[model samples]
Target: MKPSKLLITLLALGVFASLAFGQRRNQIEFYGGAAFPLAPETFKDYTKVGLSGNAQYVLFPSPRLGITFNVGYEAFSTDDEKFTDALSTEFTGQTASYWVGQGFGLSPSATVKSNLLRIGAGVRPYLTDPEANTQFFLLGQVNFNLIKNDFSAKEIPYQYDAVNDQLFFLTFNDEEY
Candidate 1:
């Protein structure tokens, strides 16, 4: 099935379940999981991995389901820095090493947060705890992510002086990289 159709189906199911379940106050939850980039071919000279986690609160509109408010963190990483260094080092006798840190994302969605895994065509399943006051669960969420690329690490630069056949090395702060 297409992503758009699947998303719409999940939304409809969420609404139905929320209206059927009623409301509860002790509905807080926490979850952690990892994500991977889907379209690596779209980007050349880059490889990405995504990591994620969340804390949630469910507010039931009706017994079986509720609308979930989630605050989450996600990350994406690429090898662009290394690729760039490779291209530059060939022309000059200097070798440069660079490390690219991860990229991050945040997700918020309207979906059903429930304990029971409804069996059938359009139901979404949620992982839950029946025995804890402050519960922990895992729910798969489909969301469009917005990424902010900040944060970097230190870099090292080295040069081979071909004329004198001598080696030189320099260290730099995160800002220079």
Candidate 2:
């Protein structure tokens, strides 16, 4: 089975178990933390640190077991890089020759930004008694994430060949996807 489906099944089971045999205590909590990329090499030139925040509402049917509903957001740092490439034109119907301009004059650069929204359910089990001043718990959660990416590119100097009526530089101008 898919990982997401398996996670949902476990969360549902936890919720149902808590509802069947647990006392009623409702609580709300807010959390924030830094997220580290598990596979930083996959991202190439991007930063590895991300910021994350979440809010959760818990319903306890028993002193030890609780069902939680959570909503969260995460933002990854932006990364920028420069690339160099050449554009060429081909001539036909007469003497055919390719005109190529290769140099650092066309400095192209790009920036990438990523963000995510998360919604999920989980089970939290308290290790200590409910009356303790400090409470500790083991938590398991299943989250569905919506991801957004913004990619933009630009050329330092736009170049055009009027004789061939061709624009040598092209860019998306800070578009989000």
- Against the true structure, what is each candidate's TM-score? 0.39, 0.63
The lDDT per prediction is 0.44, 0.67
What does the lDDT come to for candidate 1? 0.44
- What number of backbone clashes does candidate 2 have, counting pairs of residues 3 or more apart or in separate chains? 3
Q: Report residue 37 deviation for candidate 1 (angstroms).
A: 1.5
lDDT tens per residue, model 1, 1-177: 999999999999998767556344436767766556555353323445556666766665433334565666765455645534543354343334321221112111111111111111111233454434654544444444454433232232234465975544333233346
lDDT of 2 by residue, 1-177 (tens): 999999999999998878765555688999999966564353434645799999999988788888899999988875453221211111111110121233334445556677789999999999999888999999999999887767666652245566976545556655633
Superposed Cα deviation of residue 167, candidate 2 (Å): 10
TM-score of 1: 0.39
- Candidate 2 lands at a TM-score of 0.63
Residue runs of model 1 more than 4 Å from their true location after superposition: 1-23, 40-45, 85-144, 150-177
Which model scores highest in TM-score? 2
What are the clashing pairs of model 1? 21-62, 21-63, 21-64, 22-62, 22-63
